[model samples]
Target: MTATTTGGLPVALLLPGQGSQHPRMATGLYSGEAAEPEFAAAMDEVFTAMGAAGKPLRADWFAERPTVPVDHVTRSQPLIFAVDYALARLVMSRGVRPAALLGHSVGEMAAAVLAGVFTLPDATALVLDRVRRLADAPPGGMLAVAAAPGELEPYLGDDVVVGAVNAPRQTVLAGPEAPLEKTGQALRDALFTCRRVPSLTGFHSPMLEPACRGAEELFASVPVRAPRITIHSAYTAGPLTHGDVANPAYWARHPVAPVLFWPALDALLSTGDHILIETGPGDGLSRLARRHPRVRAGTSKVLPLRATEHGP
Candidate 1:
């Protein structure tokens, strides 16, 4: 791993989760200097297979429109991955290398690719399969609860589970839509804020146990390798290694595990103060990073890679 500066600050690559994807997210890169025909072609094929024709619009539109659905798990997963891959390619083309990489949920696949754990083709394939399995799961979904992670425990039940601990006060809960709705209502009654996620399929909860098993089997069929750079594990809340890559079960069970982002960020910050770039279509991760005290202390800089005057 790259050591931090004298101020002990290390740079990190932050990849966003599903909610950050937009239609036309990759359109800006269609003709850029960093544009990769092979990558674009592969994405096109994937979208075709998924029955989607093109990229979603950028999340910026959500600010102006209230009804645009950018949260469909299938669409959100691939688009965010594609857009983040494009941005990473653009950054690499510009000669910027991060000390480490961390991604939330499906975004981890892109980070894995960047870290050299898998080729783009293999990663994309795995992601598509993962999305398909997730979509086919039972009728459930996720909800975002705006409260301290521990505070939300009271709302969890046999059916509902904490999907992700995004920040100090932001936690995502996953389960059946009905149970999630009930949990959301409970949070509201407790004077807490809550919102439903895009797709109505549960992820990162016990509901995905079966999917995890399938993932494990598929991972065993594929090859796993060591990343060239440091890659933090959202599943483990620490760095991942080549050995860990051997377990397809980890990837399979990952969706059902709570995202320990706070600890991941804590570990990243311990390395040093450095620039933090959000390799996706929106500024959600960047915003989250800024909410950290160390980040607010100017120990790190958060940048979002969008289109440039010359294009993406």
Candidate 2:
């Protein structure tokens, strides 16, 4: 939805995660001057790196043709990041600025890039590398559950673990695929709605422990600088400083770490009334933000950068 008129300048920018990316998402925005070059460059680099020969997957594929397996975490992560980065750059070029930035799941990397914590080149490399690492990890997966955190605790006993805390009522579970199926069945039997996520690997769960160690070593060698703006970390539900970047272990542990998105969003709203701009190919985060009490109370507004005129 279009933001209701508020009294102050925009105070926050919300970026989406892996589920949002689609091929040619920037076609309309690319037609504009501010976004054209960035979009083209990101596409070229990503395509070249992925080595996909045919046209990239787009939303049209879902409606016009049969679905394909383009939602793999490796490709999805960078693809979503590229779209949001382009959108953020375009907004900045147009003189719109935010007092703070936040992202969910892989969206955090894009937020880091936008906040100036990492250069595009470094961030892109890290994202691609993360995909490679995650792909090579153990075979596990994640599933969405429509129960509140407390309600889901009984299910997290032995096999399943909480993956993402998207909101007060939504949580994601990660574990071995077999366990995921069992978990989903159990939740369904309990009358709780659940759906399996696309990625076949458990992310933000204990399954990533080994990869987290390797990531920590990788981050030690990479140089992490400061961000131009404040960036709230979903891992900690607090602001991330340059010093935090040096500890790659923290980021590596992140995937298996529980996502405190609702709390992070709460912290973001505490700053002031903000025009929350969701920069990406999807509106998932914007939709979540709208459900938050602060946003619905007219204290904040959520906007997604979809090409369509309809509000997120």
Per-candidate total of colliding backbone pairs:
17, 5
- Per-residue accuracy of model 1 over 1-312 as CA lDDT, tens digit each: 223334555567888776666555655455467565644554454444444333332333223442444565566677778767666666665556678998888778889888888777677778877877877778888888888778887889967988888888888889887888888888898889888766656877888777656677777787778888798877788899878877776777767887887778777887766778777777778877888877798767766665341332
Per-model TM-score, in order, reads: 0.84, 0.85
- Model 1, residue 11: C-alpha shift (Å): 3.0
RMSD of each: 4.8, 4.0
Error of 1 at 40 (Å): 5.6
Tell me the whole-model lDDT of each prediction, alpha carbons only.
Answer: 0.72, 0.72
- Alpha carbon lDDT at 257, candidate 2: 81
Assess candidate 2 and give its lDDT. Answer: 0.72
The segments of candidate 2 whose C-alpha lies over 4 angstroms from its true place after superposition are 1-6, 22-38, 41-68, 307-312
